[model samples]
Target: MQIGIPKEIKNNENRVAITPAGVINLVHAGQSVAVETRAGVVAGYSDQDYIDAGAIIVDAATAWGQDMVIKVKEPLASEYQYFRPGLILYTYLHLAANRPLTEALLASRVTAIGYETMIAPDGSLPLLTPMSQVAGRMAVQLGSQFLQTQYGGKGVLLGSVPGVAKCHVVIIGGGVVGLNAAKIALGMGAQVTVLDINPKILARIDDEFEGKVQTLFSDHQNLTLAVAAADLVIGAVLIPGAVAPKLVTAAMIRNMAPGSVVVDIPIDQGGIFETTTHATTFADPVYVVDGVIHYAVANIPGAVPKTATDALTAVTIPYAAKIGKLGVTDAAKADRMIFTGVNTYAGELTEQAVAESLNLPFHSLSTRL
Candidate 1:
């Protein structure tokens, strides 16, 4: 099997899909690996590292021209020309957010597999979890940085000084991202509150934090109150492969205090806030909407490439190997999780959530196979 690792061309997306160690593993399994030159440079691995690991250093075209292409982010517009029928694209394809990319994949007749949609038997997103943790943790750090007066914030410090009241941090969705944000916010001595639709998750958060952080049921009334009073709001809501629900509406943003910050972590899957227009790059990460600051960097983990690349490759390598050993079609048929990851195949949308989100016709992978 021939596998290609293309350099991520997204804005500030430094993490590569495969590390040198990952290449070594694939080579050991009798698979041919081609890595684009400097793909792993930003991730702290030099070209010699890949060469030492038995990977061919090639140009972008040669790398993309492989049987299977593994990448960190989805293919950008420039790379669309490289798409061809029967090529396997394994990456985080947030199709619900990008209609153009979705159309391109279908038109090209490529077998597209989304990492975020792949669900294990236990209903966990194995490939997306590690990056989610990194994004979740970074959300707080970025949110805090934007809250300073220098950044057009209300000038409230997240961790208050002696005799000063701490900033109130409100986090929507008590999932991995929310919890990690809460952990960091608490560590900074800020008053934290987490809201979620799931009572069980809220209860678990309560137990985990030992009543240090407030937990509330996520509803219109509660969300309205929390947003209005919060100094920083972290929108971490997620609905698997579907677009994130707009819990924070324009009205909510309007009512919030002037200069309050919002960090929408699920921006890749169409953000949780109504005002979240498009993804901003790390070069220019935030924008002002109705007097409120928004930090919606689509690839938050990319800011820490070394940690993110290793963490991402650690989990993705096994699945990539499986797909390489057995062709994409056979791998999808063999593993239910892999099948779930198939967003588009043979010019049809295989994921129901993505199709419904985009108003496209949905086709079952079984039928396509």
Candidate 2:
């Protein structure tokens, strides 16, 4: 089997799909690996590192021309020309939000596997968890930075002074991202409140925080009030393969304090705030909307490339190896979880949620196989 590692070309996406150590593992498995020159450079892995691990250093075209291509983020428009029939693209394909990319994949007949949609038997997103943890933690850190008056914020300190009241932080969705955000916010001595649709998740959050953090049922009334009163609002909502539900409206943003900041971690999945027109890059991360600031960088973990690359490759290597050893279809036939990751298979939209979201016809994986 031949595997390719392409340099991530997304804005400020420094993390590569696989590390040098990951290349060593694939090489040990008797698989041929091709890495684009400088693909891992920004992630702290030198080209010699990959070469030493038995990977061929090649140009972008040669790397993308392999049987299977693993990448950190989805391919941008310029990279679309590399797509070909029967090529396997294993990456985070947020298809519900990017109709053009989805169409390109279908037209090229590429087998697109989305890391975020892959679910383990225990109903956990194994590949997506590590990056989610990074993003969740960074959400608070970035939100805090944007809350300063220098960054057009209200100058409310997150931790606050001994005599001043702590900042109020509201987090929407009590999932992995929300939980980590809450943990960091609470650690910083901020008043934290988390809202979610699942009562069990909220209960778990309540138990974990032990009354230090407030848990509320996520509803229109509660969400509106929470956002309005919050010094920082973290939109951490997710719907797996579907687009994120827009819970915060423009009116809600207008009602928030003039300097309040809203960080939408699920911007890759179409964002949880209605004001999120497009994803912002780290170069220009925030935008003002009705006097409220929005931090919706699609790739938050990319800010810490080394940590993110390590975290991503740790979980993705095994799956990538499996797909390399046995072809994508064969691997999918063996593991339903892997099958669940297939968004588009041989020109068919196999993921129902993505198809429904895009108003396309859905074809089950079993039928396609």
Candidate 3:
């Protein structure tokens, strides 16, 4: 089987789908790997590295002609037109919130396997967790930097000294993103409060931090109070491949203190706040929605390409190689977990979550398996 690795086309997304080591392993396993020119350059892997690993360098279309195509983000509008009937486009197709992209996949009849929707036996997102961790950590750094008056944030230091008040940060959701945000906020000496609907999450965090950070029961009233008092608000929530619940509303943002900072990580999935819409580039990642500073960079980890590329490759390589060797149909038939974006087997929504999210009829993969 031939596996294609394409350079990410998403704005400021420098991470590649695979690494030189990954290429080497796939080749050793009797699979052909094709990489586009400069695909791994931003990730610090030279084209020569892929060549040395026995991968053939090719253009985008030629690479996509392979049995399986691995990528970081969804294809652009133009690339969607290139989608053939039988090609397996394995990537992070965040389609639940992307109506247009989802429509294109269904029309093209491509066997799409979303990286973010791949769940392990433990019900954790194995492939998406690394990227979430990077995004989570960067959310704090970005929020902290943007909070300075110079960067358009309140003139408050995260770690306050004598005769100064500490920055108060309110983070929604206690999943991977929220936890990582809390770590950075606490490390910076800010007053951190993480709210979540799950008591299990709160209990675990309480035990982990030993009262270092506040864990609050998630409710509209508590959230409103927290946001009103917060110097920075980080929106980090996930509903699998579906759109994130709108936990933070425009009215809530209007009630916040002026000059307060908000970083909405779920903006890619339509956001957990009413104010945010997806931004195209890192150059202008925010807009004043409801008069609050919104930092809704969907590819938040793209800011640190070197670290993100290495981490992303670590989690996706094994799975990519498995599907590459076994073929998409066989892999999907064998392990149901690998069949996330089967929106159209021969042009039908094989995944129920995707169908419901997109308002399309759901068809079971078992019917065709």
Candidate 4:
């Protein structure tokens, strides 16, 4: 099987689908690996590195025409035409808020697997975890930086002096992003409270933090109170194939302190905060809303491409090798764990959530497979 790694063309998305070592692994598994010229450039991997790993260097046109085309982000409108029947296009297809991409995949009849939805047998996101870790840590740092007076913030420091109190951070969803934000805020000696709908996840947070960070059952009332008092609010809720439940209202932002920040990390699935329209960039992260700042960089992990690239490829490569060796049909059957987001089969939206999102008829991939 021939696998292609296309250079990520998403704005500010510097991370590639696979790495040099990943190519070597695929090659050793008796699969052909093709790396688009400079695919790993921003990730600090030279073209020579991929070539050294036994991957053939190719141009965009040829790479897109391979048996399997793995990408880091959802393809743009122009790239949608690259999809064809029997082609495996694996990437982060955040199709809930995205209608065009879903339509294209359906029209092209490509067998698509979403990296973010590829859950492990244990119900954990092996592929998405690395990005969650990076984005979570970045939320705090970005929030802190954006809080500067120059950046139109309150000019308060995250870590305070002897008598001064540290800023408060209210993190929604005590999953990976919330926990990571809590860790960073704790390290900075700031007050942190994490809110989540799942009591089990809240319990896990309580145990992990050992009473350092506050874990509360997420509710509108509790969330409003926390947001009003917080200097920074991180929106990290996720509902697999559904639009992100709006946890923070626009009116809620008005209640918050002036210059307080809201980082909506789940902007891809329609953000948890009402103010989030679409993804923002690291270049200009903050936008004033009712005297509060909003840091909604949907692709926060891309800011640190090198780290995100390495972490993502660590888990992605092994699976890529499996898909490359077994082919999409056999790979989907053999690798149950990696088949979480099978949106289309021979020519159907097999995933119910994706079908519902696009208002298309649902067809289970099981029958087709």
What are the per-residue Cα lDDT tens digits for candidate 1 across 55-168? 999999999999999999999999999999999999999999889999999999999999999999988899999998999888888988989999999988899998999999
Clashing pairs in model 1, backbone N/Cα/C closer than 3 A: none
- Could you tell me the lDDT of residue 133 within candidate 2? 96
Error of 3 at 155 (Å): 1.7
What digit string (tens of lDDT, one per residue) describes model 2 on residues 274-367? 9988899999999999889999899999999999999999999888889988889899999878999999998989998899889998999998
Candidate 4: worst-modelled 10 consecutive residues by lDDT? 337-346
lDDT of each: 0.93, 0.94, 0.83, 0.85
RMSD (CA, Å), each prediction: 0.8, 0.7, 1.4, 1.3
* Model 3 C-alpha lDDT per residue in residues 185-250, reported as the tens digit of each score: 899889999999999999988887898989999999999999999989999899887777889878
**Which candidate do you rate higher for lDDT, 2 or 3?**
2
